[model samples]
Target: MLIKWSKDLEIGVPFVDADHKVLINLLNQVDDCITEQEETTVLGSVLEALVSYTEYHFTREEKLMELAGYPSIDEHKNVHQKLFHKVRAIYHSFAADRESVQVDDVRSFLQSWLTSHILVEDVKYRSTCIDKSEAAKQAGMVPFINTNGTHVPFNEWGFLRVLLVDDNPNFGKLVSTILKAVGISNIEVTQTPSEGLALMSRRPADVVLCDWVMDEMSGTQFAAKMGEMEIPSKIVMLTGYSIDTLQTKVSSPNISAYLEKPINAHNLLDTITRTAFNG
Candidate 1:
C-alpha cells in the first residue's frame, strides 16, 4: 500500500511537518524493501535506519514540546517509551527469525498505528496551540498616535482569544467557562479542527488550546496545517501521555504552550493569560 501526504494531514507547523515527511518517507522505504524480499543485509540496514531516525525524530519533537511548556509531557513520554520498547522487541524477533517477520505485517502495523495516531491524536494538539497563539496576537496588538500624530505601534497588554478544540463537547464547554471565570471572555469552543479553522479564517484568534489526541487528527498535524496557512496564532498542546514521547513530535513556533490533561483551572488560566498578554 502506498502512503501519501495530503493537505488533510498537515498541521501547519513547518519544522514538525518536515520531520513528519521524513518519517513517512522512511517508513515507506522500509515497506518497499520488505516487499522486494531483500536480503538480510539490506533489511538490517533499513531496520537500523528506521530505529535511528525514530530516536532522533522523537528527541527533537519532545524537546520542542517541552520548550513550549507542554503539560502532559510525562504521559506522552511514556507512550514513546512503550513504542520504542516494542520496536526493539520487534527488531530482535525479526533478526532472530527473519522468516517470521513479513513485510505485510510491519506495514500493516505501522500504517494503522501512524494513521490513527497522526490523524486523530496529533491533530488535536495542533488545533489547541494555534487557537492560543492567535488569541495572544489579537490581545497584543495596540496602536497609538506618534509624536507627529501619525498612528504608530505601541506595546499593549496582550490578551488571548482562546479557541478550545476538543472532541468532548463537555470538556470544551468546561474550558470555555473556566476562561470566562478568569476574565478571559473571548473564547470559542469547537469539536473539530475544521470548525476551529473556519472560525479562525473569519476572525483570527490569539491563541489555541488543543488536546493532543483526538479521533480525526492528531494535535501535531493540526498545528502543522495552521503553520502552513501562515496563521499567527500560538499553540498550546495538551495530552494525558508521558512527556518523553510527547516531546518527540512537538517542536515548533506554532506551539507556544502546553498543558496536561485534567487541566487545572487556575494554572490553565494563568498560563493562558501569561502567554497571551505577556507575549
Candidate 2:
C-alpha cells in the first residue's frame, strides 16, 4: 500500500475526506502497477485514472473553498496547479517513452505528495465553516449514483469485473480505456456478440456493457440470448440514439440500464454501478 488512511490525514470535510479515501486507493493501485512492472498500457490507464480524478477533485475542492469564502483559495489552487502539472508531466513522459520513466521515482514522488498534501495542507480546511449549499458541503458532489439513487462508494470500484462487447474495435478500446481509467482493473473486450456470448459461457462477467447497434445482431438480441441462457450479468446498453426514444425498443429484462454514447468515465461508471451492483 502506498498510504494507510487514518483520521489524522483527513480534513474533516465529508466530501473531501471521501475524495481522499478514493484517491488513496487509486494511489495504491498505481503502486501495484509499478511494483508488478505491469504492461505500459495498464500503467497508463491507472495513471490516466489517477490524473483524471486528481484534476476533478482539485476543481471540486477549489469550488468548495470559494463557497466557504476561504481567503487562501487562490494560494490553495496554486498549490494544486503545481502538483497537477507535475503529475501530468510524469504521465506524459511515460506516454512518450515508457522505458525512460523510472518506476521507483514515480512511486516515491506520488507517495510523499499525496500523504503530505492531505495531512498538512488539507487539514487547514477542516473547521472552515461553509454554512451554505448543504448538499455541496456534504458528500453530495461525489458524482456517482446507482439506479436506486444511492451514492456508490468509490472504493468498491476496484472489485468489479467488466466485460464489454462492441463490434467496433476502436469503440471497444475507448470504452475499455474509460473503464480502466475509472479504476476497474478486470475488463475484457470482445468484437462480436458471439465472442461475447462464448466468453461469458466460460466465465460470466459481473456486468456486460454491450453496444446497442451491432452489425450481425442488435444489443437486444444479445441480451435476449443472455437472458435465455440465464447468464447472471447486468446488461448496460450503449447507444448513440436518444435514451427515451431508444429505451422503448429494449424488451429484455437483462438490460438494466441504457447509456448514450459517446461515453466518459463518470457516466459509464455511474451507469455500471447503478445497474450491475444493484445499489
Candidate 3:
C-alpha cells in the first residue's frame, strides 16, 4: 500500500502543505496505476503531470524561501535540482520504451523522494515560512507519538554513524535515502553481514541496522559475532517475522533494539535514538 497524507507530514507552511497534498494525491494515483496494472498512456499522462507540478512547486518554494530570508535556500535549491533531474531522467526513460523500465520501481523511487523531502528538508523552513491557516494550527496541535504512546522528541540523531546491512539492495537504498534526508550522513550500506563486519572493523559505527534473515548469516548470529569481535556497535535487528522468536534471540548486550519490517522514518529514528543514548 502507498503512504497517506497525515498531520505529522505538515511543515507548518500552508502553501507548502497545500502543494504537498496535491503531490501526495498524484503520487497515490501513480502508485495505484502501477499496482492496478493500468494502461501505458494513462500512467504516462499522470507521470508528466506529477513532474511538471513538482517543478512548479519547487520554483515557488524557492521564491518563498528567498522572501522569508531562509538561511539554507541555496542548499535547498541544490537538493531540489537533484530530485528534478532524477524524476526527469526516469520520465524520459519510461517514455522512450515503456517495456524497458519497470513502473513499480519508478513508483518506489517517487514515493521515497517526495515523502522524505516533505518530512525532512521542507520542515527546516517552517519557523520562517508559515501562515496561520487552520491547517497549520491543526498540524501544530497534533502531537507525534511512538508505538508506546510516548511523545517523540525530534532531536539530533544526525550525529551518529549508521551501518545498514540488508540482502535486498532496493530496500537498502530506500532506507539510506531516508536516513540522509533525516540528517544522518555518515552511513555505510552493505548487502551482506560479512561485508558489513569488514566495514565495521575498519571503523565502528554508532548503530548497526541489520536484517533478520539472510543467506550467509542471521541477525542474531551477526550480533553474536559482533559481540565476540568487540565491535562496540549497537545492533538494531530488522525483521518481518514474528517478534516472539526475535525477543529471545536478540538478548545479547550488543543488540540494542529490534524494529519490525516495513520501516518508516519515525520508528527507525526512534530506535536509533534509544541505542545511541543507551535508552
Candidate 4:
C-alpha cells in the first residue's frame, strides 16, 4: 500500500510537514519495491535511507519543540526515541541477515508507523508551538550537531566521556567502537582495571562501562575502590552472567546499571542517558 500524505497530516509547520511528505514518499518507495520483489540489497538501502532521514527529521522536530518551549517535549522525545529504537533494530536485523525479515513485513510496518505518527503524534504539536517559519529560524540558530559527526538521540549527552575497562584488548576496542557508533567520541579505554582507576583519579569519566570478569582487577573490585575514593562517576557493569549471579558478586550502590553482553546499542544509550540524568 502506498503511504500518501494529505492536508490532515500537516502539523501547521511547513518544514516539518514537508519532511513528513518526504518520509511518506520514502515509505511508499519501500512498499513499491517490496511489491515488485526487488533484490534484498535494493530494499536494504531504501530501509537504511529511511532510517537516516527519519532520524534527521526527528532531531529537527525535537529542536523546534524545545525552542518553542512545548509543554510535552519530554514525552514527545520519548515517543520519538522508542520509534527510533524499533526502526534501528529492524534495520540491524536486516543488515545481519536479509532473510531474517521479509521486505513486505517491513513495508507494512513502516506504512502503519508513519501514517499513525504523522496523523496522531505530529498533530499534538500543531497548535502548541510557534509558526514553522519562526521555528525554522530558531532551529537554524542552533543546529544540534554532534561533535563526533554521528547522530545521537540526546543533544545534552554528546559531551559525556566514557571509560571502557576490559582485560581483553579486542573486547575493549569492540566496546569502544560500538560506543563511537552512537556518537560517543570522548572515550578512554584501558585493558587493566588499575589503569582505569588511575585514569579516573586523574580525569574522571562521566560513565564507566567495565567488564565484570577482568583478570588484573575484577569489576567488583574496581567498584569497591571507586567507592572508597568517593569517585562519583556512574558505573555500568558489563557482565556475561545473569543479574542474579552478578548481584551476588558485586552489589555496590555505586554501580548504576548492569548490561548483559553483547551490549545492545539502544540499551547502552538508554542506560547512559538514565545514568547521566540521575547523577
Per-model TM-score, in order, reads 0.44, 0.59, 0.52, 0.49
**What are the lDDT scores of the predictions, listed in order?**
0.62, 0.75, 0.73, 0.73
lDDT of 3 by residue, 1-279 (tens): 477899989876765676687677667756655544434544555566567657757876777777677889899999999999998888678678767877668878987998899879998888877753543444333322245634334345556799999886655655664465435779999988999999999999999999888999988888988988899988888887666778876678888788765444456666786778655
Q: Which candidate tops TM-score?
A: 2
lDDT of 4 by residue, 30-105 (tens): 5655544333444555566567667877988988988787889899999999999988888788769766777667
Candidate 3 vs 4: which has more TM-score? 3
Superposed model 1: Cα runs more than 4 Å off: 128-279
Runs in model 2 with CA error above 4 Å? 130-135, 142-279
- Lowest lDDT sum, 10 consecutive residues, model 3, at 137-146
48 Cα displacement, candidate 2 (Å): 0.8
What is candidate 1's CA lDDT for residue 48?
A: 51
Pairs in clash, predicted candidate 2: 146-274
- Pairwise lDDT winner, candidates 2 and 4: 2
Higher-scoring candidate on TM-score, 1 or 2: 2
Stretches off by above 4 angstroms in model 4 are 35-38, 140-279
Worst 10 residues of 1 by lDDT: 142-151
Query: Whole-model lDDT, candidate 4?
Result: 0.73
